[model samples]
Target: MTTQLFVPKFRVDECLAQVKECLEKGWTGMGFKTVEIEDRWKEYTGLPHAHFLSSATAGLHLAFEVLKRKHGWQDGDEVISTSLTFVSTNHAIKYAGLTPVFADVDKYLCLDPEAILDKITTRTRAVVFVGLGGNTGQLDKVAQICKEKGIALVLDAAHMAGTRYRGKHIGYNADVTVFSFQAVKNMPTADSGMICFKEQSDDELARKLTWLGINKDTYARTAAQGAYKWKYDVEDLGFKYHGNSIMAGLALVSLKYLDNDNSYRRQISKWYRDELNGVEGIEIVPVAEGCESSTHLLQLRLERRDGLLVFLNEKGVYPGVHYTDNSEYEMYKDCGQCKNSVKASNEIISLPMHVGLSKNEVDKVSCLVKEFLKG
Candidate 1:
């Protein structure tokens, strides 16, 4: 069988059962299970607050918009970000009318703190740090810098559903953090995310903004006693970005098994490292020290990445690329200053990473990689 890049593993019965609850209740849109998942997420992460959203992209945009409004930031204010990420990370900045100042990445393929310092100017209002492949490269340092400079730190933790630093879940230090529960993410929900804010006020604002600026959600309105409970004034112009009960039901089930699944993913990563380490012409990306990564992706850097990818495809071993440098895109062409990001973008390959893969499958993929490198 051909090894694909990501194959999400879901507990079919459990997922169906969760969905059944939503179906039987006759309510599945933006309430009930959505609220439960939000509570569960907060409990799981120990974050100050968690708000369910339609996608991480929405959460990211909300983070910037809320922060921008809260701090009275101008339209042209800058937000430092890495180019080696999915375009959603940068697009969210643009959605909030902020300029994305590209920063270089470290060996972990995460934003480099030193590079972030270089990008900061008076107009710099925030830094959106991506914990690529669940590795927290210098995030502590980055947080410290943001604190000292009085700039907001928005962690684009799309790959960091269960990532932890120093035995504590991430997002504790950042001003705001967003996590993806997309279909193929470590936690496989159809398409949903959790936005965590350090302060309660921000979380409250995000809730209103996510549901089209209504102070009270449908769920809250339904639960209230008197008349006028249904009367909610539009606090601000907002987007239809709130998550639904159906997606939240899936997230609820996924969150239950996340730790166990991540442990297995780490084991798979270890197997790959054992097979690929010390192989000439290949460099396995290193996880940051003290970070128990969710093992979202096992990325590697090699000079012959494109050729090897083609070879692997021919061999029925399908790997993938985490990203191409955002600066290479026409919309972001003018922001292309990070040399390391451009180079790494050319070299990085995300090997097959998912819960369903067996040890033999990993060996098969690793052997294919080694075989191609030998030629």
Candidate 2:
């Protein structure tokens, strides 16, 4: 059997039950359950406002775009971003007509505060912080810096479904936080996300912007008693980024078990930490202090990362690389080198991590890693 890098576990029966209601009720679009899930998400994260979207990518785009228009950011204004994340993190900055200044990542594969300070310029409007593999390394420091500098903070929390920092949920401190519920994420939906903002006004604007700038969503219209209720106006240029009720159904079911699933993932991470402790030529990435990460991935740094992946593959175990340096991409080549991110890009590997993985499977995978290194 192949030991996959990530195998998402879903509660099929419960999910089906949720979806059944959507199918039976004849109301499966942008309302009802989606609203329920949004409320639940607010309860879960303790953020003031939440808006469900088609994907985290959409949420990311809106995070920058909403703030940019609201703040009147110029076309070429800058947003400092880590070069060690998925392309969507930087791409969203571009979509908002803002430049993404690539910053270096730290040992924990998160944006380094010092690097952020170096990249900030007069036009710098916001900082996009990615909690890589759910680790919040130096995030509090980064948050403090953003606050001190009076810049906005947009947290790319795709891996941070249930992550917490300093005894509170991770999204509270951020100006805007986006969470992924993509099929393979900790919370498994077909593909959806939640964007949370600190201000209710921003959240209301997001609702209008997500549904093609319509002031009222269909659900709101449907709830009205008179014909005039259906009459509405578009206020701003928006996109069809609203999430469907079917996906919301899945999210609602998955949300029930997110904390439980993340706990098991952390256990798997701890097992790998114990099994790989003191091993030569391998360095486990460290989690931040006061952070209870979602443990979305188990990452390690070592030489010959590709070679190790090949060896693991031959043994029916499959690991994967989280990302390449975003600066290496054609669109970002001019951003100059992010030295630490470049180095980490070459050496980091994501070991198999997910709730479906068993402890025995983790042990076997760890032993193979040890055997390959010793050879």
lDDT top scorer: 1
Tell me the tens digit of each residue's lDDT in model 1 across 148-168: 999999999999999999999
Full-model lDDT, candidate 1: 0.93
Residue 191 in candidate 2, Cα distance off native in Å = 0.1
Report lDDT per candidate: 0.93, 0.92
Give candidate 2 regions above 4 Å deviation.
none
> For model 2, what is the error of residue 148's alpha carbon versus the real structure, in angstroms, after optimal superposition?
1.2
Deviation of model 2 at 66, angstroms: 0.6
242-303, model 2: which lDDT tens digit per residue? 99999999999999999999999899999999999889999999998898999998998999
lDDT of 2 at 107: 88
Candidate 2 positional error at 335, Å: 1.8
Q: Where does candidate 2 have its weakest 10-residue lDDT segment?
A: 332-341
